[model samples]
Target: MSSKLEQKIAEFRITFIAEFNDKLAVLTKLWSNARTSQSLEAVKKFRFEVHSLKGSSGALNFLTLSNRLGIIEEKIAPCEEQINSLKTVIPFIDRHMNSMNEASRNTPNSLLVLQEAASLLGELRDPQKNKEEITPQSYRDIKIALIDDNENTSAVNAKLLAGFGFTINQFNSIEQLEKVLQKNTYNLVLIDTDNSTNPSEKMFAFAVKLRTFDTDVFILSSSSSFENRLSAVRSKVNEYLLKPVNITTLVSKIRKNFKIDLIRPYRILLLDDQALVGSFYKTLLEDEHVEVLAISKADAIMTELESFHPDVFLLDMHMPNISGLEVARLLRQQAKYDYVPIIFLTSDDNIKTKLEVLECGADDVISKSTPPNIIVQQVDSRIQRGQEIRYLASRDSLTGVLNHGQIMDAAAHSLRLSKRQEKPAVVVMIDLDHFKGVNDKYGHLGGDKVLVSLGQLLLQSVRDTDYVGRYGGEEFMVVFSNATPRVIESKMNNILTAFLHINYTVDKQSFNCSFSAGLASSTDHEKLSELISSADAALYQAKDAGRSQICVDVLNK
Candidate 1:
């Protein structure tokens, strides 16, 4: 039995090597044909063959074989270049074919070399072929049905596939195929055209009906003529192989179509603990396209969160080590990941819990019982909203500067810390003098344009550490941290001078605008309000004395 097994293994290796030679010949023929014809149709067909063989060769780990093919592809790089025609490409294909043929015949260890060549050629043809080796899966229980009036063809095809470890069913008629299909779900179906006199029309009609059975169809054709091929494609056959078919070619087609690539399903940590609910959610998330990772373990939250940078999270509210709120909070505390969105998935309808979860920095809160479609929508909406909020929070919606509120809040915090460290903070209050006149003259719209311009000017004038804000309409506040009185006064004066020369156009008339300024020191007052108020008094003095002048009020005078 062991000796028999050894013989089978040796035979299989010989067959594999032989098939490699056949693929090489086929590739050369296609390439040479493509070069000779130099038609768009020929190139398209050649590309299809190259792509298919690349996938097969990569699967078989024929790197060197693939790379040599890649050399042909690269030489024919600009496939659209009509200038050269097939003259150069045809010779290249012929040479490569000859070299591969010689290597296959003479070298004993050439099989390994040929395999490597195939892999390289495959990689050259498709960069994605560089993926890790795939294990050919063993199928102990895969049920499939074969539908064809030709019993001999059906049995032969089934036996060939069965050798590759597929469990197949052979049926002689559409009626028999339908009966088996009603009882079993098949990964594939094989249909033969030999028995039907008007095969193409009948095959097309049968394919339309068989689609309802959810089985992929593989058509067996006696020839690869354009008429037959067109009908096969129109019927949406997963594969169409010409007969007296090469069993290896049939096996390759079955393996290519029926074999699952076994891509690891994306590991998603679903924080929900609900039993079938979590699995249902997972199933819904798994579109035919993406891998999904769904887990219900509440305790391994950190581990899961760390390992899987999920496209999204469906985090449940009530978990053991930490509530979803706490988890979200912890996620936000990490500097590297604070912005990662955590959507709270909860069944709790309590408004308070929802609010708390949101306040704890959850990107969004979604109901556990939310529809799968709604969940996807919510996830998308949450990501979009988070981005918008981040932008709005840092920006002034009106003038597009830092908003006065945020600026003041930042200033207050920074001022407190600076004062604790015995550092000085200079505060300046800027009032746009006669700004009301701009509105009155140009309408509010023109005034808005001026205000926006002023915001830009102020933003540009400030140092990196200096903060500016729109205090109120026509009033701006600036806080200069670590500035001495002299430096603050110089900067304030420069700003006033810059505004005096700023030319604004309105109604085809040029207008030069100016602003009144005020200054105070952090040493004068600990509170931002107090410093602002003192600066306001200085500003009043500037307005009272005459507009467009700077004033400093050491005391409220």
Candidate 2:
């Protein structure tokens, strides 16, 4: 097995041991209560606890513990009638607890006992019977609006979008599009500035108007004039496509902007002993589209952290055995969990107490009596801020694409994933044609504008699964997932042609620029370094052939 797989198994073992200890503790308490009071309620509680433990143990592959719990459960299956007989099962429960404690300590004898116990339990039931089935969610209908003066163009665009399960409404003019926007909301709006009869300023104004409604807007234009591109930026256009847009690229952009391909549910871990209070908090957060896992046992923290990987931890100020502060300190000691957000939920409103909680490694402390809405807002804000900080760290300062080191790291990771999954990927290296002329003639500011435009273009042009990065000054690298050589060549060609239309003005004179690109796919090489070297060789070939063209690396086997 690979080291990665071995590490994952080790992590699972740690979590399982912790959770088993917690379950054992709970069972011990319930067993003691049942022994003292031979009532039907006590018997029912004991049986239920044993049944839960049996299920958890089996799932975690602790067959010995599971089998022992199963025997105890079977002894109490008669319910109230077996209440008085439950005392006879106390020895078995105690033995199981002892075994679990030894297992937690990684004792060889306990491990041998567990293996023997598992062999005995093999006759009870199929171990795989408890595996859960996962069902895929159905896709929702997406509504899109297309605005263009040309009927043919609008119809073609609408038809293509419709094929992707989008309900498209085509408008022949900006006036018609505006009228529909007022009455209905759309997931996306595609405007063709070149096909519009309205002037450039008027088209930009309409885009600005659409932004007010918080709808994702994409511009399809044949013109990439500096003025028009700058206007699109100011109008907050989500994507700008050069005229005669590539249908595949357009769909990819729409999916990315609307998060159609990203269904990331925010995961939250709630640590509280108060069952009722924990339920309330879970329900409130779930209503806001958050996935919450609540654990009353403080010892089970490691288990939930490993499984759920929560974005934020909602920890109670006080928990039995382990206080929230102590738990926070323990978590801080672990390198993997050092940066995770821990918000203390407490009823104590004393300022001194809140400060003390913060000192104990809490990111924030909130009163339990605070309104649910405010609590949700605080949690959501903190998660969002954390995401933004992470995003900024990985991105280039000027272009918002991945920085040089990040891009290389991303490429290496992607290559490993592709190799494991047996999927194909393409790497395209791009260099601006006559970029030094732009800097020398139009000045460095003009060059910066060109770089920013290309950055935005690359970002908007690729699929969400693809990675775009600023490799260096005027060079960019794009890693396209699950793409073939043909696809990479076609896409890069489209981008190159579109780039030529981007006009920049210096003084009263206007100029345009283009880019040369080289493509290398998974078929060409297995290693990321080899792929990059192949693409770089191709890029040099493109530069030698002409300044504005794309060359595919043909590796001789």
Candidate 3:
């Protein structure tokens, strides 16, 4: 095989291994959980992993592997059978996964075995069907209303949606539509701007009211006028379909705007001097719903930028001539693009240079010294941060945490995730004991040094998935998802030990600062305010019983 194809195969093997590793980790965690909740979560996670692998293998044209994975996914989705069933299959699955890892371009028998296993899965689902089993559906019954004065357009649009299993309501005018909306609840409302009372004004008012019901509002217009599209967007229309809509495009827009199986592929731009580097990144990123743009030269970046408006810029900082930092600066300066996040990849071990590049506008500076997996993770984090910033308010300058208002928003988000995942998520409330005494003893600058050290320490020690925010002056809150009381206590102990080591210097004079933390888990359904209150009560207890120690209070102390 040629070198390029060989590299591609190697990358695929790595991705397959990583995915299996992730599933194994999740399965291990599920097995260790309490019996009451074990199967449900384990089954869900297992199914999700297998389903993901099925699609991935299918896309790669690994028919046998895809088919087998499909069967495994189906079996695990309804893992209601005893845990012994899993125990029995887990060993076989592990061996098969290992076989995939060992198999090469010449391993046809392994492929045949995978195919047979896949075929057997269909038999398990329905013994009669000798064919592949269709995956179970989770289609939601969505009610949508279309308002258009034109009879022909409304009928055509409604009929098109009916084929997709949507229940459609048709209205001839704004007045009729208003009455229908008031009388019935709809998931989405489609308005034809051409037939509105005052296209701009009425559309805006309708959008506000429709949004109150949390329904998606969309505009259908034949005008195709830029002004009309702008007005529709201003009126908070989720999307606008131009007149003489192609049925496919219209259906796609409807499904996409409504988030109905409209999964977007992640877009990754890989810039490197080496063709192998770009190809490797492309292969890895493509497996995760990503569109990879591999460019080898800094000069060709503009061409790629024009054709592919990538969500992220993964630029090589060591590129000749105009470096990644230079390109990043240019991109940020452009009026068309300043929001696009840039992550620079460098082999240089110098931290000072890396910090300078970050200051130059790169969102993240990742070392090429790390593994490819770490590189992918760092890129994912940078992209996730950009997405999160849209929903989060400005972070606090002092504590580097979400300010007062943003904390509630983050708490609510963590709460929902905790409940859905059925995992333990904890909130740790921390307060500096005798904070005022320290400020008085060491001066305000010394107090500031302590807070900065605490922030840095927390960010460094916590898991990447965990969130830490400055709740207020001398107080911080941590959102620890998928964490237990013991795990959280261990983390807190580390924090206390680390805090003791931090040497705070003010005016070249050294000083010391200490803190106490209290943790409460989200095992029960409690409000965000209530979770914090419980944590705060525990914090008080820790403070009352000598500070600088971690405490977990089950009683609402």
Candidate 4:
């Protein structure tokens, strides 16, 4: 068989074993309780547990184990009727439970036990079906409404959001918005408050109306005045953005409020020589929704490790060609996987052995007898910490966007891609309008909020394929792939329109903020620096034209 196919089967085996182990653990407990209680209810519970185990084991292709469990379940079936005959049933229960435990410890022996148990029970039918079970349904469809008078702004926002799998409906008037809200449910309502007279009152009333329908509201306004912010607070607006809002920030806010994560499942690489033991560990991790790749041959470990890019490594101490300690050392030599957790699983309880393993680069040592729940918890904790560390290293501390170096690196990569594909990529230099004035008026804390808000806006506005970053204080940058100068300008304009409506408050005083952006496309320059410089120059022109507008650089071909 092909290595890939073999690996796939091994992975499935691991997952099945993990699940079976958990079921067995529960069955062990239930059996013990049933024996002591000797009640009809206890017997029924035991039967149900065994029945479930039979079905699951069968579904996972553990036919031997399934058949054995099925026989045991069948024997317990008549226990409720023969509840008074507890003494007679207890011996049968104990015998089966001991056989099952022994079979679990040695999977190969399970078939022999199954045959013996079947003979004693007379006839045993297959408990597993041929087909796989259906997966549960995913998250429901997410729909949003973008209400704004500017058709250009609405269209751009709608297009960007639609790319994120949202159904967007545009509305130019409150009446039109109300009509849609009354007729259909929307996950979120994004309204442009720039045209409203008494924007605060209008927003509050609109929010009140939305609340009746249990809809989330986001307001877009050019003014960040005290009254407006207070109104948003009163109306419990989910998000308040200034006109020319960052599309990235808007999308992020929507996702945050809605609790959405695009990151895939945590991946784990398991290394063990014993197929059964490796499969068991793999199953344990998979039960926690982790993606695991199990490799029995030490020679295949590096290949699997490189391909899987696992967040954590589970290694068995004793192997044919290579020890777990040696594998950990080999992994540690690779700089990329340096911080990746290496957990050693072994039956060896020797203190000297564990210390030696740790010294050899294993992060933690787990006994083979460790409970499934504890194993999962330890692995999850380590993975989470690793992720958190990576996040902090890659993200801006305050705004939670890409830091300067990370953004530049991303831009460089995007530029390389653009050059290779011969596709146009645009970079926008963004500056918050009158940002210093905000600090002077409301202190640095308020200014920080404006910066954070803009950062969030830019992060949300850009496509997942695009890169947005905090360039420096009061400035940001967005790298858009396969975008023309005109398209970038239009999108930035839409962001500007939305950004102007963001409200900020300081000691009862409220104000709004705006931003000016300059767009430069890859067609203008071969280098990221040149593109950024051109964008910066155009951004100055935007400021000169008056704040809160997007300007495109007139690049000579």
Candidate number of the best TM-score: 2
TM-score of 1: 0.36
Backbone steric clashes in candidate 4, count: 43
Local accuracy of candidate 4 as per-residue lDDT tens digits, 230-288: 88988888888887776556755665556342245678988776565566567656755
lDDT of candidate model 4 versus the reference = 0.71
TM-score of 2: 0.46
Can you tell me which runs of candidate 3 are displaced by over 4 Å?
1-394
Q: Highest lDDT among the candidates is held by which one?
A: 4
Q: Give the Å error, residue 288, model 2.
A: 4.2
Angstrom error of the Cα, residue 82, model 1: value is 74
Tens-place lDDT per residue, model 1, 1-557, is 12333343334335556666666667668766776778766775565555444433322344555556556555554564563565666677678767976887776645644544222222223322222232323243456677767667676667655543468878777766666666778767777777655557777777767777766787876767898778767777677876777654564455335433222322344665544445545554453233456666766766654334454556767644456777677777864355456777654445887789779877667654343345655665554454334334654655555676677776785577568768888788888888888898866655665676676577767775677788888888888877776787888788778878766655555676788988888877878788878888888989998888888876622
Note the Cα lDDT for every prediction shown: 0.63, 0.70, 0.64, 0.71
TM-score of 3: 0.36
lDDT of 2: 0.70
Candidate 2 lDDT score at position 67: 66
Q: How much is the lDDT of residue 501 in candidate 3?
A: 75
lDDT-wise, the better of 2 and 4 is: 4
TM-scores for candidates 1 onward, in order: 0.36, 0.46, 0.36, 0.45
